[model samples]
Target chain A: MTDESRPGVGPVSLATVAAQAGVSIATVSRIVNGETRRASAETVERVRQAIKAVGYHPNQLGRALRNRESRLVAMLAANLDNPVMATIAASTEAALRQAGYVMILCDTHDRPDLQDDYLNAMRSQVVQGYVMVASQPSPGLRDFVERGAPMVFVSRRSPFGECSFVGPDNIAAGSAAADYLLDRSIEEPAVVYPSRESSTTRERVKGFCDRVIARGIPADRIRRADGPGISHLEIGYAAAQHFSAPHAWPRGAMCISDQVAYGVHRLARESGVQIPHDCEIVGIDGSPLNAWLAPWLTSVEIPHPEFGPSIVELLVSLWGGEPPREHLMPHRLAAALER
Target chain B: MTDESRPGVGPVSLATVAAQAGVSIATVSRIVNGETRRASAETVERVRQAIKAVGYHPNQLGRALRNRESRLVAMLAANLDNPVMATIAASTEAALRQAGYVMILCDTHDRPDLQDDYLNAMRSQVVQGYVMVASQPSPGLRDFVERGAPMVFVSRRSPFGECSFVGPDNIAAGSAAADYLLDRSIEEPAVVYPSRESSTTRERVKGFCDRVIARGIPADRIRRADGPGISHLEIGYAAAQHFSAPHAWPRGAMCISDQVAYGVHRLARESGVQIPHDCEIVGIDGSPLNAWLAPWLTSVEIPHPEFGPSIVELLVSLWGGEPPREHLMPHRLAAALER
Candidate 1:
């Protein structure tokens, strides 16, 4: 039982306890595996004492295989480096733990090959379900969908459209961003985005463009700055080159995300372009940290804290054989409008 | 085997494939589990064909139990909401994946109770090893250490001083910060920290205070500001109140982390104090994002990217039965001092 006694020996096993208790291995196995009905009460007590004496650790892997349940849930995220994704991951992990499931997080790094590898690995591990965050369509994902796997997509919808989704109404968020800028007397506001590859970004851009054009702002007058869709900060920093000049700057600008907005702000400062006085900027992804770390940024806030419980609820419903449904969480502009 | 034909049917099992192949279940299991040497070539061919036809997925849980290897690693982090932690998690996950292991992340939220729960849960799941990030000593942790579990502490050393550690040299980083400020002709400087509960913060503060005092500054003039140790940003923001006024402002300041430095900067700007000109500030945790998003923050950069591979390597060494060792990664100042 003590380290001093077991110098280079392997972990204590059922056989060791069985030998120590003067019982058959079957009796020890039955007692250790919770099949005590097969053994007498006195025999079970003897086996328990032997197990404690030998420091026997039950093999959960064997138990999980026999029960056909690992109680392991996998979360395949596009990137964990993003604050939004990290926030969602933290909340989801807490929620999963509360539900008696351990969450296995795999970062796909936004690569299809990596996603495929993680999916295959998680499948082999026999995870009960999955939560995909900003996932992309891959053959492995399609196979999971075809096989009727329980999954929920967060911050993005499944391209296959069969799984449940939990995210903000990004289109409405974009429209709100546009309206906020226009209401501040800024005409010909610019919209900066990394790429339209993601549904969130594509829909947000669509909503902003449609609303601005409907309000009589000429399509050509509304500047649209797009970048290589890599790092959000890099995208915003690159976009700033086209708008940092006093003559080129729009009276107002909306960035795809808070990180991008920060990039724009950093570049503008370096370029001697004063915010509010020269041009106002707004961002999305109202991360809670912004309240203390980034008070200057005005953004449409997504309910990141609710994402964990909502996603878990949707996943549990899926497990109960409920029809897949979409859950659209609300978004609102955060921070004061005044410069 | 198709979804339509197998409507309401359970997943294909080894027996299903064995029946389809006209072979014993044991024979089919052998071929599927990569023990083809036990079966004839024709039998292996038949089992492979039947597996494809019946859409059977091997139960890795069973094989893992037999092999005594789960290929599962758990990472226990204090907080994931912090960008530094998020960056480390992403890189660590990638490195783990590259090593053919899946990482299950557990956020302890800096609570010992949560840490205990995660430790117990991970133990039940039979993780091969652990990577503790800013871990606090707990009974479960002590049990693991006593039992000789393979674990490595990242960003902080084990409070028990019995496990491998992979992190930056905090003392050197703090000394670098002090020298950076002193070289800039700032006679009086302030140090803002959340708490000294963590080894990283404690060492950094000790290094800064020691170096400054050795260089002839009075210990009382060091102006150490400590907060409730809840939120790093709030700590910095609160500390800023003591130095916002012109009479109270030190010519220079050193913050615990980049997040805390951002809080100070935000507060100073609101209080009409200009950075660099009013009070030169330095921060630790040179997050890669700072290059594009926070060009104004001069920080001592910890090589976040290198942490992943280094931690993985240390864990592998421990698994190989090597003695526990400490890895102190190098740190240096990032960005221009002219800011």
Candidate 2:
């Protein structure tokens, strides 16, 4: 039989797609959203049959209007000057654009009140999803989630069980840095990273600490320093000042972010401490600019590009009525600076 | 004493404020928008009195809703990785926030189609104002302007004459850079900047070139090269490669952006061009992190903090119904990286 002669042949709309597919409108919406559910063989077959019978291409904006959805995604960033966050925002936006969505970029500047305000403001915008990078969610965030807008956390972990997350494997990143430093036979390693409070910083430190302990390094042999989470370079300089003094320095060091690594480089140069020879160093977040930094950053490559795809998958699934889950993407330890 | 007994006592709506203040509501709105208008001393006093008497806090949001006006401002940026734009966005947002407004940031990634799409989307949102930083204005941009959203160009100058603009004094920055380089007595000079098509880059180059010509050096004597606008380090590397040949190289150079300066530094180092001795360089946009780059960056400081106040002044003025005009902010060149 010719394609046009098939039964249930018609133009695809919410109604026709639902009826011919033998499913409810909500089910069709869920299927389109890519929700996690196993449809019955017969129902799935019917839907597939209907979809094929009528070339139904759902109008994103039309559906959004009907649901009062903005089709606009909000990305809350704590700081953009931090290359890591910039990279994350750029990649995430790129992904969002491909998925037929416009992202509203909001910089919270690590202020609780501002963060709350943006969250509150977002509530009236009819936004479909939210993406936050290393931001501390406030009461407004909970209210937003309750309003049925799916949210994804990037570079930050949320205590809220319902929100999905996409970020680098911080634990592995830390462990790899330790291994890199130790592989070069640096016994006493010092770790300097941003904010002692940030989960990202803590996770990296944890991995490095675990690995250093696993390698038989004494607890006292490892030194730790914390600085402003976003201003890694500033912290690196501070760490360097302490390290430059004869009694204050550690034998080896790993920076929490590439920006901090840049600071360490400057300090080492100013103090005449040769990298890898004086104090081997590594940074995380593997910004592309690291390649051009003076000594080229020996950093953990946190698949910044993959963030775009991963975020889309999560958002699409959520829109499809799927439950939220945390996703951890693997990182590559680029020892570019070592050579 | 009763409100009537007081000098400021009256019916304090538009009429009272107008009657007591001896100014029209339009004038009050203009003052609120930060427009520079000459209101009589008595009028100013009366307006203040009327405002205080009636507690006339402008309901920006409420007014917007009733009139189908979106007090939301849309900012179209090419890239957030460029810290300058981020700083500007942050500053602008802060200014708008104080006025009970929020900014919608869209990254066009230098694509005309994306810019068009974003413009259309912003139009649909009924944004009160628009700010764009784009090197080239597409057809969609023209259409957007015609559709009647008051827009101000930042950094990027549009070919159209109708739009208002807010940008740094590029000529001053360039001359300042040249002055710094010459004060150091580096005779042979090279220039590395983004593509000449960029308004800022062109302005900087013209200023620098003019200074060089005035110093009795022929225009052709300057070693100049333009690279892909995206990567700063690449431009730096290219500069280094050009100057670090086995033969003679320029003794000094100025980069368009700090990111580009980093690249130049890397290339110079790789080519064994010693900074401040064999070569010295200056960069634009004095980012805080510039000091962290190895050897730091000698850059022209653009006042990022003031961006918020300036943008708000312009936006509020437009909101109050003023015609478009240009505003220029000054810059200072600082010796960030000195040997």
Candidate 3:
């Protein structure tokens, strides 16, 4: 792209101005972004003229160069398509903005390499800190933490426990989903779960299984189906196709997420199965987008009203060299919210 | 945030390394990131030891500083919550990455000032180029365009046509929506449109009205509803409430977006109105997320399979200083797509 097209790339450097003015790039930068005290009046005029002629731009980089700080925080999200994650990112950005810190967003799409790249790039750029919503774990992130990089994790924790985390109580959310199914007299239930590569899903499934076994339900009775290949829809379809059979489908199902629920519902309709009547479905994360659809995706919502602000606060604490803390937000089922 | 919490901000400058090593920061920087030929072996060792002692982190900034360039492209989107926008963003990011550039995302939340802030910040950070989906027009964007900052407009044209754009032909989409409604034998068709701040909405409304008038339908017969307090549901709820007043409701309504159609469907259902049988609705930008819901929110499907790649190519052309080209991607109604 033309120099103009590349706005994110560094603009014409002070060196260009210096070359035109017969001065130094350092001289030009000092005169442009910082105090022009070191340069003589004649030299300053020459540098200014050269800068104007070269179309040189001096921005935050000048200030950052002098102070050696960018005062910027970035949030590495796994995917922006997920409304729940999007909400968290928005709130975090807003909270950071209000606190006079600019937020840079990078979505990794669950690729560990991409996650590492963003982390490395941001570090190279001298971003102040980061808040990560680890859709998937990245060893690169762990390296940063090991190197004493300040970070706050959300939705997923650092596998090594070297960082602070503020996230939902998945165990509670899973238990609520289980209790709802048991109360509905669903004797045989199935769990449509994504890969256990995700800690959140693992915790949720564990909580659910513990609750079910405690209620005297045999572990063998509860069917576990691999929900989706990626935990969005197609995988849910696969899981639904596997679990749903004539007179053999589970009476109730706990989905990894509402997205999985949507897929299950679509698959069931295609198969001519009735929801609630034949099989009831409950999922986690009652996303706002679900409100657009009929028969609201009954979900257990993890209360995260303070998620954004709390994470920001946690980052601040980390900056102050505080020990890493695991903060769990509460959760509630949709029915409980109404009551 | 503390000094350590902010890894992105300038971490341990050459000055610190110099102070520890009893040398100049510039000398330290040159030896550490640049050439070390000027510095003696002992001196370089002292600088290195100091750097390690001070916890100085040398990252990507060192490379960027020397070259004054970073291959980064940014997409300024209005909202990530909308799956349509998210899809576009994901595609664009993937395309950019494929072309050996990193994509930085900034969601404007449909606010002009925030958009401006991101633009300014990106500029300060020396980003190479930008692809804008103008949520709202602000002089700041126009100023950048006039200054000839490489920009590519998506979904909207630059108010001051100094840049290239890649988007759908909204006029034809609107005409198609009108023709479909007319073919259904609806006479009293009303247009549920948001404020004409968006050129996309303006073009769609104009085409619909022009087509209706050409079809011998009285221009006055087709009513228009105020469609936004915000583009998605709340205003749609308001429009639905206004339209469904006993005998006043329009027999057919052309909504500005599928989101608006969804809101109308919800409001109608609450009022016990049968869809298609009593009221037929059509909207624009058939989002993939809409498929999850029952009774599909029929819309004009703008063929954007190449949106991400096409726009990336357009930006590449702009970077090459090619003339600004207005690229109109094709579109078809959802009904037409099925056929």
Candidate 4:
């Protein structure tokens, strides 16, 4: 097949176009790069002809180097193993691609030093914009902005005033969980999650608390548990054990995540507690896996697929020199298993 | 504090170290780079003094440039949203880090072009090795290996030779699922998953089939379905509807993944099918989330945390000039809800 029509491998580069046209590299570059003001019509036409003949594709990185606008967006994430973050990454990539931007991914693993390294690397690479999902931002991030680079936060809002943030409306998600439990006629519900220190967990808890207060549920009716980490099963087992202990258990529960809820469900089943009938449960971050349980879990759908658009919008705004802002997408309250 | 000790800042680069030492950049670089075969002990001592004074932490990229070994492993996954693949990524990163290697991640979104782009980028960046959990090597990957880059495949074996692979013994996992169902005294059990194109899926099916054949269960007794893609809920809903149909469904089933098993559980509950007593379900990929679901899924636990170390070992072996081979780690069959 001709190189022009090759499936995976593309055409030759701009240098080949210059060679084919018997012209200076500068002339060919100027013509192809649309610096028509500097190029003669005949020269431009010759360069175009050469480009067509050699099937030349301009180097995106080289072009970006000259313009200082790479049309490349960098996304820094703490963990891709989290389905929520992965969905956000996928969505953001699609949205950015649609806007004629390429994406480069970096994983910080929640380490401050690594985040600093990535910020500098993104700067040196001259990516047009950045999206950071990790909660902690290193000093280098501030330095990068001071040195002139635009960035947006997703899933984590930066304390600094210069960066925009996009994520789910955690408070609404939490409140919705409370509403679902209350509507199910359950009186008191415990809350379980990995850490209350995180913005997501805090917001979720705040909403749940506000709703519980609004309903005039006694303060002593609520319980809270800090899960070990993302290992949801352990959290569930522990929480279940705590809840099933004689009269200490709350009548209902809201897990900070679906994974944790699964753990609770397992522990409850093992403990011989009936679900929904004895104690109702709700989870956040509606995962696809939750549906496979014998009793369908009631959950708050975080709109993971749409997270990309929200992140891309923030990045575009930053690229255009807009002030930092925050955006929270709506939540979805899923139905629970029918008795 | 010295900039090196700056909290939330990154490690000081070689440039800073050279500047702090007040020596020629080359001299400091030579010393730090262990080019000491020719350098005098005094010169090395001076460089070391400067490094200590500045608290110089070497840039990993620069170190790689000098040594021709990045010690930065790259993992290219098909879909980060898939919980199974996410576990693999997490496990692999943890393993590589323990071995003093940082990990770079890429999600190819199951596209050949995207896969090729990531492979090419990883190769150009001079990543120390590759751990791929995706199917089908892109042209860039094949070309890269032809030019000599160490690689290890996880989950999927490549058509090309000269690469190491590490994954579950699918035959064993599948057979175990079948044997477990039979152990429960179920006459017939159905197998469920989303796609047939996956190599892992094929292996799982083969293993399950082999066991069933040995048990004298007719081939037609194994019913298969597209469990769910990114939506296990849909799979659960579908399984529920299928099994709840007027005609009787199988008394037991084996799901391809934990996510799928989750759906089967839901289906059974919605259909008023009692697990183990009326129907039983089992799945692969021991995601911690399985613990919270009612009836607690019976699953095969692939060693997720050790996955990374195993892959790194394979890469190191290849780097040491080992020939193409396949390695399987032992796994556990855990009964979270039922024995």
Candidate 5:
């Protein structure tokens, strides 16, 4: 009755351990899988010894086949080159690890086809869950979720479908920036917003511009320029150059991210436009590193330490049913002038 | 005979397509698996239509089971928050993807136990290869390599075992920094070296200190302080405070990384010290962002753009057998002194 006589069970399996320990297959399996409460003390020890004697590496894949789901979680990132993305990713990965799952990091490089391919691959792997910083949600993504995949969208909610999302309240973040500029009584305020339109980006821009116009500041007074989704620093620098050419440099500027603000600072120095004395600048995404590395980032900052972990928690909560509601992480505007 | 009559094959498997099309299994497989040129056009078109009608999802898992390997590549990282590490990962992941493998990122957070657990889990999963920036090599790492896992170390060679390494020549980078400081006639030079001892860091410190001693200057004149391996910027800020308390502030500081240099600059500004006029700083890891964000960083820098991709290339060349030797990429001192 030994599995050694079976054609394909192989020499290193639960049957082999059971045969060696002179126990039932059920007893050996329970011991190997850490369900040892039912077995006798002597039996547990015997099976443990047998496992080592046979050099048995527990077959997680075969176990996963029975569960019909891999303990692997796949993350689709728009791009990995961005440090902010890293900040988000680091947070998500740490949280997932704590919950007993491994993450497969896939960078779609913002291409629809590549994103589709990874989604297709995920099905083949039977991964337990999906999380993403999606770029232009396609039918492939919707299809994955529709098939009842445990998925959560981070940074921006999917425009194509209603689902769980965990990110900063961009509208509020944007409005806060406008309020800061207005309270300082600055004239000729401007912005460097990314050309890419996510619900997240669009909300930030609308909040800022709408608040400015609401306060009787004409829309024309708010000079605006486009930056790409990634590499906002260089784009911010170029935006500065473009803004400088049209007229007198604005006395104050609001940037969508810290990199854009840094870019503006660098270009202004090159052009001999003194900060604060000539023109003051403020930015969003108040990264902790900005405090030490780019003090010039003096505006709305997302709470990364709290934001990242929350995304993972939200995903886990949805395991049994729907997420309670969309989670909104907090943001801060550090208005204290560079000390 | 129809695959419907087959005992075990699923409805959407390759066998189903073959049976429905009245063709041999090999002909259906070649066309379905992208071996289109080997099959006749009539056969290819018939198979393609059958695939659509049946909604066949390719069974990569079954193929992997037969081959006794997974197409997944596992990367063990020390820290992902640091942008320099991101550069290495981006390069490695991109190259691996182009070669038809997906990367599973595992950050050990510089813990030996976590490293060992990940190594153990890797064996359970049958990951085809391993690449790492090992914090401190242990028996777990040794066992994996001894068992013939395809592994390539980046940043520095294994601290415990012989292996293929692809990273900067830290000693050369260090010596070059020393030359820059001395040539500038820095009166009271200092260094902010990482407290962690990797072969890379050890060589850099040794090179810098050795070169200083070789010169007419005494070793004591070279002010020395410690910074963390990652988070060099904040640590640099702290190190600046540590260095400032002991006698006069050094005029030039050699930082272990560019982030450290930026930290020093921030601290100096707070202390009312002028850069270049008061304290000139040079750093290693010449990140491209340093050119714009930290023009103040002047010293030998890692060719990340070159170094990252090279690590991947080296790992690939060693796939069939051991790499003939480790790779040492080039570095340069950017002394342009910002515009």
Candidate 6:
């Protein structure tokens, strides 16, 4: 079969069109690359017709190689199932598009192996930079950083501590959650977190514990509920099992994430425990859907919409050879937590 | 500044490494491309050291151009905020990664302009195939199809036809929803949909109306709530505004999506309308989170996990020159609707 008729055969090349147009390959390349000023109108028209006749699809790979640039950036995210991650990705995609860069999003699902695979693949694709959301440290990532690749962390900080980061102040969020519960006269509040492996979780837990202790609540009075950290919702649900009875539950609690709060709420409803009336709960990462879906849940709202712009700005700054910087976005109490 | 020290000056090419190693550029290329058998062990080691010393980063673009394959596929989706879309994307990415192809996910947010932009960008990137999730067709998409590119439609069919589709049978889902309400001895059920423009919505509406009409319910008796169709949640919430009073709401309703159902549920709770007791609601796209988050809202569960494998299988088939075929996955009533 002819090249054009073959299914997986490569498209007609610039050489084929150049041969058909009876012009030099360089001339064809110039016209195809939009450098029409160097070619005569007649020659350009002839080359264009030859391109159509031969069905030549200008290979972007070739063009990018020639220009020594690929306007592609990869966003390696831990999870997309989390609405917060999805929101961040959506907004980041828009911001990147506006800046004339196409984003390639890869979901690592918080697996180190998958993260490495994506990192290696991205390298092969020559992605200009990376935006890692809740990234886990891996040898591949470290290698890329060592190579001086531009990258920015979002919603988490790099363990290596040399990359730019854009996220909410987790310690403050934890402190605020503590203060909110304490102000409500709930003296013995608990903090439920998936795992301390995450920088955000560790900082939040630290802040919560420190604040509760400083407020004259004995350290032992501040209960701690921990889970395997695989799934936030499952973590909260499993943690709540320890306090199966309504009276066994603390007067107030702080969940590391909104999803964890949902889990707690689910278990509480099943166990006949009323929210706020029995156990006031606060969560972080106030999802955009809270206003419509969970208006009653009081939580520290991370500005997810602003994350896209902040991440893109940091990436640009990194690309411009600026020293690594950290941007702490402001957070606020959303819904019932505002009071 | 030397290329190694200059940021974004392009990586040190194979030529540089070859020159430093005192070998032909072709030899260096073969060795770097993993053709180690063709080079002497000593030469290979020398080349490797030269590569490191010169800070050479292999450009995949040039390699891809030579191979006439990118090992990349682009998923152009309508919206990522929708949990269903995010689920599909995550699963598809895993499947594609397993098949040795990296997915580039682009969220168009249901805008025609953005769709066109992503399409154009993907073409320039030379994506091998496309997985369109509820895609809005545009001139660029038409051009790609006209060029005989491989593509598969997910959760929606291509408007132009001739493309493989993988999704739940929406008509059956709608009929099931209607049957579910009718079995409860509830008559005068209303169908709430964001827009009939979507193939899924159109089919669901048809099935619901047909089933209702066939059951002796007059066409006029079945109230239809419509919204501008921008946001599914807002659509359902706005549609619920017509039935502001608890008594005004129909005894049963079928929401086009789970998200829309959430909107209706939100409004119903605000209006003091008890679910199932005052109004029973059924939705489509039973999100994975429903078991944990929305067990009470009945929904037709689309097999989102299966979607990834099915879409990848179809893409492979299309690549192998097989004729386009439709694969309608099985859907079942989830949660309370099962009975």
Q: Pick the candidate with the highest lDDT.
A: 6
Order of models, best DockQ first: 6, 1, 3, 5, 4, 2
User: TM-score: which candidate is best?
Assistant: 6
Query: What lDDT is reached at residue B241 by model 6?
Result: 84
Q: Which lDDT tens digits does candidate 3 get at residues B1-339? A: 235434544565667778879999789879876689999999989988987677666755455555766676778888766666777877887788788777777778888899888887788776778888755688678657767777889888887765688888889888989998999889989888765358887898998999998999999998888655665666676778777564667778898878778777777777767665678788888777666664445688875546888888988887787888888988877752211
Residue pairs clashing in model 1 are none
lDDT of 2 by residue, B1-339 (tens): 223211111111354555556678887766545563677666666677776654354434334434556557888888776778878888887788888888888888877788878876665554667778753668877754654457778887776666777888888888788888877777767788865367788888888888877877778878886676466667567656655483566778888778788887777666777765676778888877666654556788888767777777876777677887778888886775657
Q: Judging by lDDT, tell me the better candidate of 5 and 6.
A: 6
Sliding window of 10 residues with minimal summed lDDT for model 1 chain A: A3-12
Which candidate leads in DockQ?
6
Candidate 4 lDDT, A253-301, residue by residue in tens: 8988786777777666666677666777789987755544533578898
Error of 2 at B238 (Å): 3.1
Comparison by TM-score, 1 against 3, better one: 1
DockQ value for model 2: 0.13
Tens digits of per-residue lDDT, candidate 3, A1-339, equal 235333444566666777889977777778886577888999988887886676566666656766776767888888776767777877887788778787778778878899987887777677778888964667777667766677888998887665789898888888889999999888788888775458888988888888988898999988998853564766677778776574777889998778888888777776767775778888888766555563545788765546889898998887787888878888777741111
| lDDT tens digits, residue span A1-339, model 2 | 233221111113557678777679887777766652766666666776776565454544344434545567888888876767777888888888888888888889887788878865764455667887877857756544554457788888764555788998898999999999899888888898765468887888899999999999988888887665446777777766756574456767888778788887777767777765666778888778666654556888888878878988898887787888778999887776434
Cα lDDT tens digits, model 6, B169-281, are 98988999999889888789998988546888899998998998899888998989877767898898988887867889999999989988888878887888987678888
Give the better candidate number (3 or 6) by lDDT. Answer: 6
The candidate, 1 or 4, that scores higher on lDDT is 1
Interface DockQ of candidate 6: 0.50
Interface quality of candidate 3 as DockQ? 0.40
Instruction: Judging by TM-score, tell me the better candidate of 1 and 5.
Output: 1
Q: Which portions of model 1 show Cα errors greater than 4 Å?
A: A1-12, A20-57, A336-338, B2-11, B37-43, B336-338
What is every candidate's C-alpha DockQ against the true complex, given to 2 decimals? 0.45, 0.13, 0.40, 0.20, 0.31, 0.50
- Stronger candidate by lDDT (1 vs 5): 1
How far in Å is the alpha carbon of B119 misplaced in model 3? 2.0
Per-residue lDDT of A186-305 in model 5, one digit per residue for the tens? 856888766776676688888899999998999998989776545777778877876664247887888887777888878887887877567777788876667665655567978766
